[model samples]
Target: MARIAFIMLCHKDAPGVIAQARRLTASGDFVSIHFDGNSDPADFAEIWSALSDNPSVTFANRRYRCGWGEWSLVAATLEAVRAAVAAFPNASHFYMLSGDCLPVKTAEYAHDFLDSNDCDYIEHNDFFASDWIKTGLKEERLIYRYWFNERTQPKLYYASLAIQQKLMLTREVPSDLQVMIGSQWWCLRRQTIEKVLAFCDSRRDVMRFFATTWIPDETFFQTIVPHVVPRNELRNRTLTYLIFTDYGMPVTFYNDQYDLLLRQDYIFARKISAEALELRERLGALWADEGSIFRPRTRGRGFSAS
Candidate 1:
């Protein structure tokens, strides 16, 4: 039996998150969630109460006011992964997910895939060489410090960038470390995670450097993962099928896209709309059905996402 531990970084949609947790637990997988400290207290309570009875579910003790493009997102993820590690040491893999993500494939299918691969499934591309980044600072994201949240404090964020550019104040990524960037969602093997966490404990300075780097959540793990795992053992791909618009926003899956979502080959699809109740309900039914494994009707087709 291949047991998986899901480390979810969630900020909103209590009911939707609860449903996701329940579905994973029902499939005999463990879930560790880090509810954002800035989220509604009532929503967190509701999620906790609903899944309290399940022994497979756990919540991270450390919470942060997670913000997009801030270090807090990485901090929350670290807490969630730590909680999952402490609770389920024997789990074969630790999968990182978001509250808005939904499983597009059956649990059994994913388990079998992981069991056979015996390697990490994380999207990692050379930061300076990759053209995947659509907008914002590229190599400069690592070279400068970002003290303000880009989304919430736009004026301050841009002002800080301008000051740094004017003053030519910059930092360097450690020569030994190869900077990599990719989608935050990943499914990593247990041993890979153990090595990565051990590295973090030993290299406090590296963590400190990334603390002010723009969107550390995307680069922190991506850079460290390669250092721990060999290139041959890494699959530079994400299991979650997520598409971003030209403006760098995820395309939300709606309730009416039932057939489209069902045909997806990936294990999960992200940024599902909160209003997509019908889609969630239908997917819930599929997850609960244990008679047969769900297969994609379409082949050689996948969503165009980085």
Candidate 2:
């Protein structure tokens, strides 16, 4: 059975995605991809050639260019998910990710546990704004899509800090509306994925409504899952885990964290720059751990490496 499917989005992070997917496949998991509207076909071909295993790649339709809070980016992902469902009907869980996301551990450990839980990990209620991701107090802030300018705040380093500094200066978003912050990525159940897509397809009007909104991914998935599963059942956080500063600043875990990451506990991590040196070291670490930790765990049969 196709146990899990990773819905990965990449603009140019092909090399990183390739290394990550290979490890996942080695553990007997199937992988699927949707290169974003921006990746050139030739670049994609180079990516395809690098992968050791054969994985399905979907072409994402980019109806419009998206900025930090723009709904279009989320719209593109939804389209890809819709396509994945039509194509891989039998998969048990639908996992979402970015090309920049690298596994902290192996897929088997994460999938084995998730498959057993038979629960979804989406949050429904409005995320009360308290520097949501440290963006602001509540009043002046916009969904990251609005406030984050890739051109102006090109890297996450600048983007996250720039936004936070502004918040410290203002300390508020607005009193009018509620704002919630969450990872754009998630691990949704097949039923839930179908339900969310069905809601969007059934109510094209609602889809249109979200598209115009800022940072639609945060709202789109958060809104749809609540309709299918009770808000409480939706997990409030990603299960794979993370490392954050004492002040709750997220520090990118890299090859140095590779040993900990490949430990039998985690699924994935983010803000990984494929351009970084750690990719190779992390891949090497996974290769070393793969034999003992990843293999027997394939069918829920071995000791967890973490």
Candidate 3:
């Protein structure tokens, strides 16, 4: 009886999120949602009312105005996870995902697979050793301080970087941290999450350092994970399927990409187009189909149906 708690960070598309929450809870999984503070009040109210009847659904109390590459994103995720943890004590795994993400596999399949495995499925690699980040300030993101939101204050953001570069003003990675980077989405064991949160609460210096770093959402938990979870217990992979362009933007699935979506064996996919109504409906039906088990075509990874 392994249960999962899904923590979703959503900013838009209330209908999509509401549909997803109902579908997720249909199989007895717990869903905790955190709507962005900047989202439309009407949409937020709509989602809240839509899922109010579901006992397995919970909403985070502390919402933050989230922005790209800002610490607010991580703050919002923390709020969601805290709500999920409080509501679902029996949840063995905790999955952090976006509002646009939807599962391609049944809840039974996800539980069956995770119950049999001991390692966490999170994508992570040493920041300096990997070339996954193609553009922007890669390694410099760790050592530099970013006080302004890149999306909202582009001039201040770049100007700050320029001043820091010119003055050689650099910061240090917390001595206890290794500075790992990875995809923001991950599926972590409950124990791992507990340890991560505990460490965060106890270490004020580490939190303060990451708060000013570039895109702390991508590196904060990633770097803390290695120090908490042992090497053998970490899978170094993600269950969510996502493809990034050469420019580092995630590829969005649309109505015409049905075949492309089905060909992948991942349980969930990221960045679905908001307008893909038919695609979502079709995928929703497929996900709720429990007659068949999900089998991964590629054995290269450790994922399996059994």
The most accurate candidate by lDDT is 1
lDDT (CA) for every model shown?
A: 0.86, 0.58, 0.83
- Which ten-residue region of model 3 has the weakest summed lDDT? 297-306
**Tens digit of lDDT per residue, candidate 2, span 1-306?**
337777767677566667766665566555666665555777677666775246544344332344555565786677667766765666788888776666655444565568667678754446653334444323333432233444545586356746756776433332432445566777888888888777767777565555545456766676567666766567766643445554555556454655544442446666554555766555535532633554223211122223
| Model 2 lDDT on a 0 to 1 scale | 0.58
Q: After superposition, how far is residue 188 of candidate 1 from its true place, in Å?
A: 0.3
Q: What is the TM-score of each candidate against the true structure?
A: 0.94, 0.70, 0.94
lDDT of 1 by residue, 9-128 (tens): 898989888988988988989999999999999999999999877889999998899898899999899888988998887788999999888887778777877888888988888998
Model 2 scores worst on lDDT over the 10 consecutive residues at 295-304
Give residue 257's error in model 3 in angstroms.
Answer: 2.9
Question: Using alpha carbons, what is the TM-score of model 3?
Answer: 0.94
What digit string (tens of lDDT, one per residue) describes model 3 on residues 1-306?
Answer: 678899999989888899888888888788999999998999999999998778899999898999899999988988899888888898888998798897767777777788888888877788889875768789788788988988889999999999999999988777767778888888999999999899989999998898888888888888888889998999887888877665556778899877666656677887788889888888777766776655556422222222
The predicted structure with the larger lDDT, 1 or 2, is 1
Q: How much RMSD separates candidate 1 from the native structure? A: 2.3
Candidate 2 segments whose C-alpha is farther than 4 A from its true place: 48-66, 123-125, 129-133, 136-180, 240-250, 259-265, 275-280, 283-306
Ranking by lDDT: 1, 3, 2
- Our tally of clashes for model 2 stands at 16
